[model samples]
Target: MTDERETVEYDSPTGGWGSLRGMVQTALRERPSAGAFETLRRQNKAGGFMCTSCAWGKPKHPHAFEFCENGAKATLWELTRYRCTPEFFAKHSVTELRGWSDHDLEHEGRLTHPMRYDAATDHYLPCEWEEAFAAIGTELKAIDPKSAIFYASGRASLETSYLYALFARLYGHNNLPDSSNMCHETTSVALTELIGSSVGTCVLGDFEHCDAIFFFGQNTGTNSPRFLHPLQKAVERGCKVVTFNPIREKGLIEFISPQNPAQMITGKGTEISCQYLQVRAGGDIAAIMGLCKFVFAEDERRGGTLIDRAFIADHCVGYEEFRAKADATTWDRIEQESGLSRADIEEAGRVYVAAERVIGVYGMGLTQHVHGFENIAMLINLLLMGGHIGREGAGICPVRGHSNVQGQRTVGISEKPELVPLDKLAEQFGFEPPRDTGTTTVDVCEGILDNTVQAFIGLGGNFLRAVPDQGRIEPAWERMRLTVQIATKLNRNHLFNGKTAYLLPCLGRSEEDMQAGGPQTVTIEDSFSHIHGSLGHRTPASEHLKSELAIVAGMAMATLPPNPKVHWKKWTGDYSLVRDLIAETYHEQFHDMNARMFEPGGFYRGNSARERVWKTKTGKAQFTAPEMLAATNVADADGRYRLVTVRSNDQFNTTIYGYSDRLRGIEGTRDVVLMNPQDIKRAGLSAGQRVTLVGDAGDDHVRRIGGLEIIPFDLPDGTIVGYYPELNPLIALHHHDQASKTPASKAVPVRIEA
Candidate 1:
């Protein structure tokens, strides 16, 4: 008999263990012993850490080992055995490390000590913690704080986020650009316009009571595998789950519950969505418009309580204007714009009409466009028409990407909106906060390009890789006077040259944070308003590494003079003190944060909109009609396809854990772009042909990548999909959402050539 291991080609996409099923089988075949399982169980429950992969909601009663494949990889990465020591850095120069891929940099292991890049030696030399902190403090103090940017990552705990915001305000700058600005800025912008709040109105319990679910731009199966259970429960209860996305994901269509014993044993999966619609890329606004048009028309014809006339009259404003505009939209125009038949839209409207309680869930796909805000607003309008708000199982749900990103913004991580937050900063901290609006993520890059931003302190993030226009961003990063990164592991952002760049190794969430006194617990806010406590399981990987909260406090203490008015050092030792300060500074919702967090599944932040109590000036939900704009990209006579950048199942934003995209049948490669077979034939190109894609006009932005076999897909005419970071160079920096300054990553016009 042939040896199973010898017969398997582990490296090859097809010949080896490329398939997800095959990978799973191999993993089980070479399974670790019971001791390994026990260790994993202990580590998973340890106080301070949460899964770093997808922001899938945590189960109320989490299993001993409840993480997914990507989640496990992220956990192992954080709890890795390897270390990036001074000796390792001495052996490799900056030039040598710069040539490393994202995976290679991370695989080199966790950073063991604080290091500063030496231009002469082109190497990262170890620096003492005190010296590193002093250098960062000096650089920050030198810059006009308004021009200094403090960027946050999603992985940061609430304690760290609150401290970062406090430090930024204390330093006289409100230029707090965070990861949320890139992902969910549109959701915040839209929700505020419609309901006077920036958060989702639904909790996990709301899913149990929902009659119908309209999911858009998110693949719950891969992005948030934990959500599959709730979706499966909803499906079992006869709830209709509808999907609207550019790609038909398997997870959306069918979900195999890892926790379900019978289903797992039988190798059977639960059907997730009752209906799946493959909407065109950047066509969400059009699809939403079409749905509204159909609903309004149906309501008018049905008459007498068909529309929520009482709710519209009593609780909402601008319905007359919205109704008129929606009525004016023609069926033919809707079909032309959305690439969906009028019959299909009306059928979806029938689902909404039949259900008394409905919820709409969306992700970054709905937010990363020029008309993202409008797209979300339209969905809110749909929910309002059916009187879905303020009821159980009915509201707008924006599936946030980062675990704690929503909480970060909730605790005041923004460059705009100068209201109570600024006033509170002055009243509490005894410093007049900068009134002038500061730079956002896009604005920071623009400021860097214009030579205005002198210093950049990234609390935690891969800014260069995350931002658009890679060609311009690389040079702009190098131009900064000083760049400081507080990170646990090495990433591509560290390679971006600066006159003075320092990498300070910090403690991961999974590690214990024992300060001068004792063990510590950090806080995180879920997709809903509920805040929960987290404690670390394992000992600190290195004694030199500090908790994010301590690092922020240390930097603040080193930079600012002693102020008798405010007690900054007290917050460094205990997170509860910081929470108390937060309550005092922002008296809205967090007044009892300290007392409330002690309870299991902490209290809701109290969204007025969720209770049908609008906080807007008029005390009513308002609707605004946005003018429909023509397609930004016009096809050239040469028939170049419009290229759109998207994420794969195995990837999370800029972090590529692996190269296998199981849903799309893409394995071990990121070079191929999914294209319709009709487009390939029309362009006189065959499958597996190497092509060079170029932007319109004299923009020298071009990407030369090979083509894979053309699968006859359902993508709309004049559209193509490819992976981001690689394709970001082709998208112009100026093409962005005007309202929020988010890059129009969803829509970029391009021509493919052989």
Candidate 2:
């Protein structure tokens, strides 16, 4: 009865007495005070709703639990009490809910009706929401809408990602695959080819006026723990920070700012990096070409100027092919592929040549890997070799993880190549749209392994445990003849069922949408682009749920077509006419974006690289080169090891909020892996033993996803680490990130066996 792989390993923290007994069993299982102060007075005020966890940037005041601990477990998992009925999916079948665990199918609750997957009683029955939108609009209008894909989920809502990218370009198909193409598509294709905007040109008061921050491959107090109170107030106002990261993240080496009430009443904890380094997980493009080859040899041996040579000769453009590829990258191949030490990249390039102002922050650990867009164009060529692009505390930030996924690729959820958002959605919905370039979560599971993607909808993620060869995303989600989803709670991609699936449910950004013209607010852009306005306060846990803008206007009114071309049921019954079609297709940046999203804390997005004004195409800011490749998970001629995949301060993104990973003192257990006592005596294994990692299991392969333990520590030699979507079946969705396909889930290549 109870053993959905020990149901989210209870309070799972596998180390120091399971993180002090899972923080005294989450403070004696809390409760009583469920009124979460009217959901924290509807977050960022002026209505409310946007904190579905991390993409931080919003507190210009408003504390008292201004959320974090993964935004209060995404606010008690969108204020859960747990639901899921239709007799709990006609009593659990899809082969016993495909052996559970993804925190036991999101702690088995919150989903109420509109289901489908019958496959002759393998269960999940209740259909009828217009018969599961006329059987998903007659099997996606008999396929070939480039075989239908769709996807999305950064917990949608910029009016349901502009009505699911205008109902997947009015069902003709630009596939729309999302979850930011398996996380930060190399920071939106390397900040749109170096500063034409793919987002993050500083904000959050540019981490309180930089003067060196750096941080690549982010671990910001376990992925944005309220960005450790603005990086412990930029290290108590002496600002330096540093960090690189291959693993040394004890919250970037010491951080204890429980929102600094005098360092959480004197248990004191503010010593966040004044230098940490580590490097080597795909050595951030040889540590940004060894910090731009030590800022071009400290501008040729301290000659007074660290190469901003008049902002690279007036705002840049291949400074002579970026100074002949930063003087053809040497420092002994950047200290032999950045394991760091050319006097720690000349002492972090002498603190980025005595910082006048720097920023750099990064994440998706430098964009998932395999030279993630030349490790984000070598951290924008070490912040444009020190002139640090576009002013006010310098630029390039990228720390986004859904809190509006870079405003769903800035209000058009692109797959764009010259489908220029299907020619601005056929000049705002009249027709001729779907120009093609579709499929992308790894080209929709390699277009469902060559049968060419036969209809999958998704809209809210966990798509087969956030894709990347989950045995080829569970048989390309059982060669789907329609797979739907839309969800709120209940996951493992709704038991990966699909010879026709559905699911539906919805409404959670903390409830209360009401609609038919009453209380409805939504916006959300954040990670420093701002935007705001969210509004849900309780109610609607179920009166048969709904609102992801009424199930994307009831699946674009039973899969569009009849009288379509945009009215989509009066723009889903008013979301200020989906912010007046996002203020008439980004009218010089959402004009009055629904009257400045009702004021309070909402609106920012102007950023011409925050004033250095270089929206590229040779207008300025361009220093691009990135062609290094050739480092496939090193150490192998019989030495094995590489691995990487991390994340566990009670996880998020592949949502497992417990079973203890309180800053790497593992608990309950996520199998464990760490390693490095001299690569466990150079792979002769042992320190708790039990191994078996092997690799390349591409499409739904598993062979031996057995138990592991290992531990050791200081990690680097020929590395290893573990933890992502539980070692994403040892990664192999064609080993990703070739110019931003993303999924190199941190380096990979394995062979631990034992």
Candidate 3:
């Protein structure tokens, strides 16, 4: 299998015929019909289902074709012709299907019925919805409330997530872990502590008027193609883009809009990055520190006129602490640590000085690290130094990875009681929520390992594969007494059977949601504050499949005491009631969720930062003092490479579209490590040589990923790149950001065994 696949350098820009070709092929294989294209036309449109791909917002004024290649694939994959019914499960046991890859499992098709694992045969047998809910209730009643963990995915809508929070708490457990803990946990931790809210301050419209954009640790071309449009427009208006990453991603360099007819005809792509700096893995803090030093030097040279003196005096705190940290750090230290020259760092500062309004964008590259929280605080320090936020076209933007992950958090999927205040919810729902703290994804994993968590119910995600140190975590996962997953398709997590397991199939986002109260439209929050109404019009894969909201409500109804304080059935059948309850719970922000959802492009969930109103502990936008990048996580041995897990253009999170990574110019394999030519030659290995990648995470567990082919590519020294989830095994379960508890998947120190 490794011998059949070969690497090829893609000469074309990101998103032209290559995007079109990939989109068409994926769609044809999944859902080959005229109806499929029609359904896609509504994707990200005025009143259509939001694509469960990346959470890049729909443009306030969208183009004719707003959907990207990956977005099309994401929705169409749900609308596939194939369906995995009861007969399909009866044919294969969990043991027999253990060898199948994640890609193959998903491609098998959408799940069509509820199933329970029969331990005798090691196979899953179909069960009634009532039976599944009863089973969950029986297990919950048997186990201690503290022993249960409820996990949520990013794609969960506001209504469903709100109910999930209520259900988990009412059933007497405070353990609520969500997908953000796996990806953008640092962003939330930094922003929530440093500023007030975890969500970004900027809106989607900021791209048009922003003078400059600094893309740190993000590849815009592939992860967020819809964002490229405004970025292209920004470039046309002379907006400079500066990128800091370990690899030269084609998207960050140049992007041709596949939706633009003129660009397609002319074959000319827009230049994306004015400057692209290849900083090493785990070097984000130092790189950001370099920018801060330059900004401070220029401020002194210009006699403080370069910074917003008035804004700083009026609305910020801790400027002195931030300045002191910057003053103590030297340029020589910055250069050595950031892997960039002093001149390049100053050049970045010069661009910042020239632009009046700046927009800073980042991704998991900055978040999933040992010092990830510090990395974000430093970026905010740079932004606050210039008084960039709290104004038009100026704020921090963290591109989210899923459809409604932001929305889910907004409606109370947080483990922190402060974010989802128990007092406020109790007043709204006539029930008091637990004031105690809950477990995060990392915490839940530890809980499972210690046997503290006996039951886990997932609300729409492949929980096992989405987490780190799966090799160690899976064994603990198997020890659980009861495990339940509410999903649209089959995933690896379903194979991990516990004493009792249930896979309850649910409706996808692109399917018709007709209920007792008539058709319903769900709302989702984007990377920005925009709320979009998603309406699905297609027929479901099976008559047995239920909506996520219904499934969640069913479980709540079965578990909670009879004649409960909250009416679960009334709200489940009528989504408006759920929206009404959400609005009541969060009256200040979502006072009229149902009414406002009907707006043409929906409305923005109010952002205080956007209005220059800080809501932090000090009631001001506080300037944070961040420490120097920690070298503690880096391996001590010489000639060791730091391996960062990355996503392929063809994939979305844990779902692998194919083996191809078109944006990075690789093809036909996920089990390949991208390495610097110098490092490759130093190890006495050439391109396509197979080697075992071993990791040292300061633990007793031996971490190794074997049989990975090496591909000599454009990566920084002492750094290598591998596909996400596949490389997740190398990351220790304990390895994570200290403050946020986010897995440090971006900075695993390793050596290649040839």
Name the best candidate (by lDDT).
3
Assess each prediction's global lDDT (C-alpha) against the native. 0.73, 0.73, 0.85
Which 10-residue window of candidate 2 scores lowest in summed lDDT?
1-10
Model 1 pairs in collision: 9-16, 47-535, 47-536, 48-535, 48-536, 640-751
lDDT of 3: 0.85
Clash total of candidate 3: 0
How do the candidates rank by TM-score, highest first?
A: 3, 1, 2
Give each model a TM-score: 0.92, 0.35, 0.98
Model 2 agreement with the true structure over 343-450: per-residue lDDT tens digits: 876787788888888988888877887667777777887888778778888788888877777787778777774625456667777777766577678878877778
Show model 1 residue runs off by greater than 4 Å.
1-48, 63-65, 417-420, 629-640, 697-714
lDDT of 1 by residue, 560-598 (tens): 878877665677777788888777876777888777764
lDDT comparing candidate 1 with the true structure = 0.73
